[model samples]
Target chain A: MDVSEQIHAELKKCGVRLAASLPDDWVAPLIRRLDADNDIRHVPVGRESEAVMVASGAFFGGVRSVAVIGNTGLLTCTGELATLNLRHQIPVFCIVSMRGSIDDHQIYQEVQGRRTIPVLQAYDFPYRVIDRPEEIGCIPDAYQWCRLQKRPFILFLTRALLKGRRWS
Target chain B: MIAKEAIRVLAAHRGDAIAVCALGVAANEWWDATKAEDCFQMHGAMGFAASFALGLALSLPNVNIWIINSDGSLCMNPGCLLTEAAQAPRNLKHFVIDNQVYQTVGAVPMVNAGRTDYAGLARAAGIASTHTIDNVPEMEKQLPRLIAGPGPTFVVLRVEPDPSHINTPPVTYEGPEMKYRFGRALEKRFGISVFNSSGY
Candidate 1:
């Protein structure tokens, strides 16, 4: 299976029924997959924090869920991450499309990309990097860790994962 | 009646109804008058009053659920109305205290300030039973009927901004802890597992 299919299978196995996201170039394929899957309800939110809160509510309502956003979006959601997710132990499974890091072509993402790990660390959140399609399996394992810990977890996706990928 | 008066009316008619107030001075006034146990104040979160109230209404389906929200906050998550309407809970009543300003955040004027109509928005979102009250006396007279009349009601309260005096101290409970406590209470009361393994 490709990366999107692999991620979709893992989320399905983990019983993630509700998913929310902000538009991002790197995760467009994953978002499309979530949309096409009838079992998964996809909510497109205006802001990253709103997505987090919605995911939090869905989780509270006994539904397994995830929120997908770009690394820059994570910076905007710090207050939410700190108060709502971390302080409240809301297990937020975030798939962050890495941008603006070392060897990144996009200059606009550089600042946020560099700060992503430090921000997650500051909030005491555990994160893993996924540089290739094969690493998609680790997402379910990361989600399990988040469920066990009752905290937010991050899966950082580098450009390498989306490179030369076809939608189908 | 004004938003404060409506709250007072609700408090007077309290019969297993739990009030969830969003963060602001208007909410603070009502919060001050009522017991903390009966109120769930959204401290840090800006626009979650309706969502929180929805949770409470669903979890405690037997109890009457009321949300004291602001126009500014309500707009932040207009999708919440769709969610509420979709769920179609018979016991949920949302009261939007339409002050038209982000009162907590330096009184910034909300989008489409005077032009926006919350009642219309609610109706458009399929919350057919909605009411708008302009003054204290109107609210005092009409609130009872609004509360008694229907399922999933929305009230747009037009009131003057009373320089928000709801004194919320700096210290507050963590969201997780509150969620855990709420979940446990809900589980104990309703026998439903709302939270996952970590207990919210």
Candidate 2:
């Protein structure tokens, strides 16, 4: 299965009934796939923070949710993630495209690649980078650990895993 | 109308709606008016209360979700209107307490004060049912229609800022306690487990 398909399968296993997203090219395929699924309610938000807030609210409704966005989008929503999810101890599962990696080669994304992990570390938000399709299976475990942690946890999808020919 | 009085009217007519309140004045007023645990009083994420409420509404399809937003908070993320319009959740109602000032921060005047057309903005964003209530009587008159109407409906409640508002503070509990209280309240109300067996 493709990386998107593999991730989708794991999300289903995690019982993610709702997904809120602001798409970046790297994660767009996965967003589109989830958007087409009937079981997962896809909310296409205007801003990245809206995706974070929506997923936080879904937790209150007793629904498992995930926020899908690109790395820059993830950077933009740190305030909301900290103040809303962190302050309230509300666990929000976020799947972010790992932008600005060596192969990503985008000048606009360079700052994010260097700063994202440090910022997340400053906030004490746990995250993991999935560099291969085989690592996609850990998503369900990550989701469960996020719930147990009771705070925002990010699962980063590298361009390598997403665009890797092995998946095709 | 005073913001508190307008909130009282809304609280009275809230029915079975689960309310999501933005931080600051709107949240304080709702807390004072309703003192209800079913409401999720946001401590931060100034503008996304509307989005949060939309998610809750979508998840709890049978429940009514109300977002008590503020002008300051709304302007912080007006794009929320576009998202809300796109979702068009019939069970979600958005109320913006437009006092034209950030009352929490010593009544700082809002940017473009008294000029922004929030109702028109919501309409332009594709929410067909929208209204602005400038007084208590007007709000009372429109409450039934607004309450019974299918959403996403946008209502802007124009009210006077309380110069004496320093006396009114937010709900006392802070941080994680608020989460547990609100989550446990929902769990009891809907018979759903908002927490795990370990009580996260």
Error of model 1, residue B184, in angstroms: 1.4
Tens-place lDDT per residue, model 2, B85-162, is: 988899999999999998878898999999999999999999999999999888889999889989888999998878
In terms of lDDT, the best-performing candidate is 2
Candidate 1 Cα misplacement greater than 4 A, ranges: A101-104, A164-168, B10-20, B26-40, B48-67, B75-93, B100-116, B120-131, B136-154, B163-176, B196-200
As for candidate 2, its clashing pairs are none
TM-score of each: 0.76, 0.98
Question: What CA RMSD would you report for each candidate?
Answer: 4.6, 1.6
Residue-level lDDT of model 1, residues B11-100, one tens digit each, is: 776565667777776566665556545455666566766765765565455777788888877887887787777667788889888877
**What shift in Å separates residue A67 of candidate 2 from its native position after superposition?**
0.5
> What is candidate 2's TM-score against the reference?
0.98
**Sliding window of 10 residues with minimal summed lDDT for model 1 chain A:** A159-168
* Predicted candidate 1 versus true structure: per-residue lDDT over A31-144, tens digit per residue: 999989988777776667766666765664566788888888877877767765666676778888887756577778778877778878888988898876777777778888
Tens-digit lDDT string for candidate 2 (A23-125): 9998999999999999999999989999999998889999999999999999999999989898989999999999988788789999999999999999999
For model 2, the superposed segments whose C-alpha errors exceed 4 Å read A165-168
Task: Name the DockQ score for candidate 1.
Answer: 0.25
Give the candidate number with the greatest TM-score: 2
